[model samples]
Target: MPVAIPLTTHDLNSGGFAAARARTTARMTATVMDLTREIPNIRAYALRTWHEATQRLAEDPEATTAIRAERDRF
Candidate 1:
């Protein structure tokens, strides 16, 4: 995931530190809640799917050959 670009708020600059802090804190809470959910994360599902596809191709000679030929030209 792409992280948000943080705005610098040095003491010398008149930036809205309070608003920035509040926004960051709120986003952190929301992200943490999402992390705790049981739904499959992006990595896990992708790994599982990749493994299944690989195993299928390995077991089937035709598929394995076709995939190899496609990748050879890819």
Candidate 2:
């Protein structure tokens, strides 16, 4: 089966913005495509957190902040 590529839509209210909006929409589409490639890894990290650590973090916010800081560098 052939996979479908996602397309982002843009709407312009005034003709004055037609040129700028096109450039912006192109940049947005490219960024979205790049970010989407990391969805699986992001999902895995989110799930792994709740496995049990979520409860511990709920038990304490300080430790959670430290862990979050480390993850930000990851």
Candidate 3:
């Protein structure tokens, strides 16, 4: 995510630009950190959903039959 900070000539001359840059950098860093912290949970959810789908395909006889029928049609 890009943040647009509007800077005036006075802000640049008076050194306010540096402070604004630091603040924006800190905010972006914190947002990235927060997203990184959720990686494990996100991975777990994805894996769990994949496993459930696999299990369902394995256990459902109708689905197995349908897949085999489709394959034989080729």
TM-score of each: 0.41, 0.44, 0.58
Instruction: Specify the highest-TM-score model's number.
Output: 3
With candidate 2 superimposed using the best TM-score fit, by how many Å does residue 27's alpha carbon deviate from the native?
1.3
Better of 1 and 2 by lDDT: 2
Report the candidate with higher TM-score, 2 versus 3.
Answer: 3
Alpha carbon lDDT at 42, candidate 2: 89
* Overall local distance difference test of candidate 2: 0.69
Predictions in order: lDDT: 0.68, 0.69, 0.74
- lDDT by residue (tens digit), candidate 1, 1-74: 99987756565245577678888999999998898783568667766766666666667758766567444433
- In model 2, which residue pairs have backbone atoms overlapping below 3 Å? none
For model 1, the run of ten residues with the poorest summed lDDT: 65-74
Give residue 54's lDDT in candidate 2 (0 to 100): 53
| Tens-digit lDDT track of model 2 for 21-57 | 7889999999999889989998897777654465555
Error of 1 at 17 (Å): 2.8
Q: Sorted by TM-score, highest first, which candidate order results?
A: 3, 2, 1
Question: Which residue segments of model 1 deviate by more than 4 Å?
Answer: 1-16, 36-40, 61-74
Tell me the lDDT of model 2 at 22.
Answer: 88
Best candidate according to lDDT? 3
lDDT of 3 by residue, 13-47 (tens): 56767788889999999999999999999989777
Q: Per the 3 Å backbone cut-off, how many clashing residue pairs does candidate 3 have?
A: 0
